[model samples]
Target: MTPAHHQARTDGPPHAPELRAAARRLGRRRFLTVTGAAAALAFSVNLPAAGTASAAELDAARLTDDPFTLGVASGDPQPGSVLLWTRLAPVPYQADSGLPAKRIDVSWELALDERFRRVVRRGRATAHPEFHHTVHVEVDHLAPGHVYHYRFRAGRYVSPTGRTRTAPAPHSRASELTFGVVSCQRYDQGHYTAYRHLAQEDVDVVLHLGDYLYEYAVNSSAGSRAYPEGTLPDLFDRETVTLEDYRLRYALYKSDPDLRAAHAAHPFVVTWDDHETENNYAGQTPENSVPPEEFLIRRAAAYRAYWENMPLRRPQLPDGADLRLYRRLHWGRLAQFDVLDTRQYRSNQAYGDGWQFPGPESEDPGRTMTGDAQERWLINGWHRSDALWNVVPQQVTFSQRFNSTSTPSKVSMDSWDGYPASRERMLAGAQAAGVENLMVLTGDVHVHYGFDIKRDFDDPGSRTLGTEIVTTSVTSGRDGSAKPANWETLMAANPHLRFYSGLRGYTTVSLGRELARADFKTVSHVTTEGAPLTTAASFVTEVGEQGLKPA
Candidate 1:
């Protein structure tokens, strides 16, 4: 942990030098431990010999600590402003007990280009423990329909470069918009080739549908963290039920440079899924969370961490143990993203773990995926939005998906199928509101799917009110699980599904005044690092079109 003993691992993999140099240049001198079996991430940044730092460099580095260890990131930008976030972790592990009392002054800048030669706006502020010391300055006075490069500086340390953009003014006659969508990325399960790929995509915002962290203990699930092959250190020593545990988990996840870089480059619109709290939490009870008495305490911790880590509006800030998650984001006049909270306010599990027949409590007319109140809000948004595309950014599939129905029902009861009335409410809302270009962008289920959101799944000829495009997991689920032929015999029974993919990757939805397109960005491999991404499938919807069509 000392600067004097810091030495880069010479025997490390290809990114060793780049990782060390990047860390050293960014003033991350204390810890450099490489983590994960992925070897490609330069691990947790292994520390070297104490002789690695020079007196002069050490003195300068001290002036500006935590330059951009977590990297630069932008999110939820409106036409006039955007959110810039970065934790000022001069001493990342420094505790409230032994922490320095002085507040660090961090300055940020926005430029028209990456080089920063033509500066647009600049400002400075103090980062302290009041808000966990994470700097979230809602930079205003930005021009609409334009891209800008941003960075932060504290003393001699310069932050990593990030890119952000503002939406065009309302009804500005915008011609087109392209945004990258991703969610549920478990660090150790795979390399972030998707983030790397996304950094290169010309996207304005990244629609992240949560599961940013898993509550499961290391290796207990699919992959390990901070180590390779199922090796998971007590990330928080146990399941995160207290605020500190959530804080620690966020710190661990934000440590990934790839994730950081993507955030720095593009503004993100994010919503938490079940893992943010527990596997699949009911109202106050967490699915698989122990001590049941600790449910509310765990929810409080998770919500607090979610707000503290995300770049959200002031109203969305955490209050006590509750944090607001549902909101709306409009990208010019092309698309309006209605982000939903599927887990926060919801009915109980409704079913047993792992898609069982007639999910446990699903039959209860009282059960709900998104509590009644939240569902009402969604209905209101659908009926009110006027954007060309009303993209419902929810945590799970909106269309009913039955695994099989010919012999016996095998579809997941936890999905919308469990809440038929709710799905009907959504369909009726869209229909009654005369909403156009209604599209659902979903995540959570480790499979990719495209569907025509009809009024009823039992009747395919039923009116197709909208379209639902579900992206697979970022790095969570393993591939080759079984071709969704699980529905082959039941295709005639439940006709809502139009397409499904059992791969791992993200989705990109592009929109113009006349048409909207959904592209599945799938990687060649997930177990290995640096896999190439390909367009596995593309679906398009014309301006007057309401259903999904193969592209």
Candidate 2:
């Protein structure tokens, strides 16, 4: 939590990033009062304005009028350029009134061939309205990790032709690479059948380790059931602050055509959790932070309406309640992925009144989850990675999942089981950087683990220290919250748990230069929406032994 204790919030306006410093010492006046209580708790939480305002205000229609509506997507890429995104939705259900801002002209192409004769790179961008009209377009130079095919014409509505790839040139030696990793998605619980089997596989990228959305309360029953349209809204009134409540919650998860055909054929690498900023919020507060100054202004208006409906790449936006969102990506030399931000520079949740939850206080090694400049920018990208897989992707479950029973449980003080010496300096800085295939990729525990990690998974003398998979949930509240006598007393109290499934699904990996496979992929249920993936489980690590075996 430093960057001079960070900044960003600027009235109804900016909404997040003031983080101040009460989290005491490493010192300067406890860093400026933890920075002015994070910027008066991120401009007192008024977070509204993310979408839904054009039922009658637009004016950009000359090139035609197909208005995408949350389709046509792509991400990061680099080598010549690749970002492209779209949102439009003109009047598909009303929100500021779609199709006006220069009537939507948004062409983008790239073929050499997903079958377009052979063209190479093309561009055009504009959806306007300061950004609610969404359309990103990064697309540069071209020719790196190959495989391409894209589409998104507007005025006559086209989209759906997407399959992209490009990353290999930083020294190139690639062999194999496949990817996928998802997280919490709660459109009234169920049916993205793990994004319709990640839009029929052949993966290239889709990490997204976050809650995507679930502020709760449309008949909120939680953890086990309710909201099959019993007229939905209440895990606290599905908690949003507005922009027609974050554009009707991203137009009900972009009207799931299997999460828009896995965001129009692959390429997604997001990061945002605590339901994108609220529950158990720390660096800025709100899950249950005793009115910690209006839950840091309702988490800087729910993280600037989740950086205005993600597909990011505008240098990850949100300047005023501050948002950098840890990043780094590459896949061609067989993987590099980083992406962290453990709930925006954390610190709070080291519990009290008799040691109960959230921790680090046995003596704060500078209370952080990933802040000492993001753990020295992830130990300097694991001492400048060489890649045959590095992949951290992150959100939670960085291996220490406590509750070793002191009884009367509520949950570990707040997970790396509450910072056991910053998870032993990030697993002894990836085992003093000889870092082999160190794969982490997790999602907030909606049950599905795998583990093997050990600086001491409760010491039988500790060593292993590498693999973890986690993943589960397109619907929250882990399917079956343990209890078959606490799953045999947590498998005789954690023997580096190898598997646990409640199942909703997502996780597919491949990496390979020797081995780096994972395939939990379950999902014949989530009550309803799209459901069908099922590989159940598989694991593997090999390539100079980094851990997890079971294949």
Candidate 3:
């Protein structure tokens, strides 16, 4: 498919040719206020002669009462900019999104106030059909540590207003910061009640550790929602395997009002785990032993759909079948967030992917959860970081979890326990870096856990180098029980495990100079809507400490 070029449309604001010409010659600092309108006008003046459709022509054919079904989102906030996103879908969940096979201009606005009285920036961007009509505008040159409101417009329709904030200046000092941790919200299992509550939290950013959507086939037993209406249609009963399938699945998930509300409320940093493509996929290899050639095609489709729907910058866009998801974000001098991608570059699971104690083959020094290149990047970042807190947000359990309290203990081959060499090296690196407060935030396992990260898990008195907090699922395993079947065995086998909960919810972390507080929030029910929420447990890790204490 050819790249789209935007043309002036009736739905967009009137052009300013003189201002556009002046903006073209202005410097970066001088163009902040005028760049938005100038760029749109300049983009309009350069439209090609062929293959363009007027806004009226397109609107008369397919416009509906509302086209912003997916709502608004902002992410990847920097000191000077934030990425704003919205998809124009009049009749969502369809192949064409009920629009002609062409591109349309979308107008956008950013303001100092929600009422649009003090408009800061206004612009237009092209929404191409090839990319599912999603608009991602990077609003730049904004003041640091300031909140802004944004929205999109198309053909007389306006999207819901979204709030976003830029990070503080690099050299500035911050005393405290708060963020929400979430993952594994399977649409088929339950309502998005966790997101509904998370939307109202006072947080700086949201770190999504993965499994944003599952690839499982829909069934009659999926939650309590009726089929062909509130739930998935029979046509989508099969697992996703193609580009259209992935796009449609994303549309289905984005249609949830609660989930949409959460995205609108705060900026999010996202990374994906197994279910985003297929369960437990490793390096180009499928979970069920399909040929790599067949799996790469599916991976490419998933990657493209993910980039289209996500509020990521151009640098993180998919190249062929790969994406660079592991990166870093900072909150002034308070915290440094290193978001990781554990699934993309990993070796195949050892011991055929389950709970067991494998031989020395699983302890191979060359094997890594994050491939060699990403490991070097992470280590380098750790060594270079000077922030008070170093936070690692990633998927899967980091600490070793044993099934029994006896010798020759068994562990899940799917987690870091399966790659002990890599886990040990990470702890050693953190120790070598002499970080002030090293904390790891994790997801997957459908349960919450607070534990001490030791340099050596085999020894009971090993050096404590960091702390690990594993958040529970948003709605993965339905309304799970308070105590899982193997709860006693796990707790006895791993004494470092301070807390655990088997339920559907998320984790909220409040980071300060002295201590970091983590609230393990849970929902009473997910099989139904409007579930009541509560803080099941709370833990605090003091600065310079490497373990969790009850708060």
User: In terms of lDDT, which candidate is strongest?
Assistant: 3
Q: Which stretches of candidate 3 lie over 4 Å from their true place?
A: 1-62, 219-222, 227-231
| Candidate achieving higher lDDT, 2 or 3 | 3
* Model 1 spans > 4 angstroms off: 1-65, 90-102, 219-237, 289-293, 351-354, 359-365, 479-494
Highest TM-score among the candidates is held by which one?
Answer: 3
lDDT of 2 by residue, 356-474 (tens): 55433733787778778988888788888887777788888887554455433334555667766777888788889867668787888676788878777657457775788888776
What total of clashing residue pairs does each candidate reach?
27, 63, 0
lDDT of 3 at 379: 86
Residue-level lDDT tens digits of model 3 in 1-551? 12344443434322345444554687545653344343334223322223554222254224655788999999988999989998888777686777775677788999999999999999988776656787788888999999999998887788999998999988679888899999999988889999999999999999999998888876644555444554445646779987778887888889889999999999999999988899998876689966444466677678778988988876776655678989999999888989999999998888888988866878888889999999989888999998999999999899988889888888888889899888888887887888758899999889988988877777768877778999999989989977788888888899889898898899999999899999999998898888888999999988877688999
Model 2 error, position 247 (Å)? 14
Screening candidate 3 with a backbone cut-off below 3 angstroms (N, C-alpha, C), the clashing residue pairs are: none
Q: How accurate locally is residue 197 in candidate 2, as Cα lDDT from 0 to 100?
A: 74
- Candidate 1, residue 151: how far the Cα is off, in Å: 1.1
Scanning candidate 3 in windows of ten residues, the lowest lDDT window is 40-49
lDDT of 1: 0.70
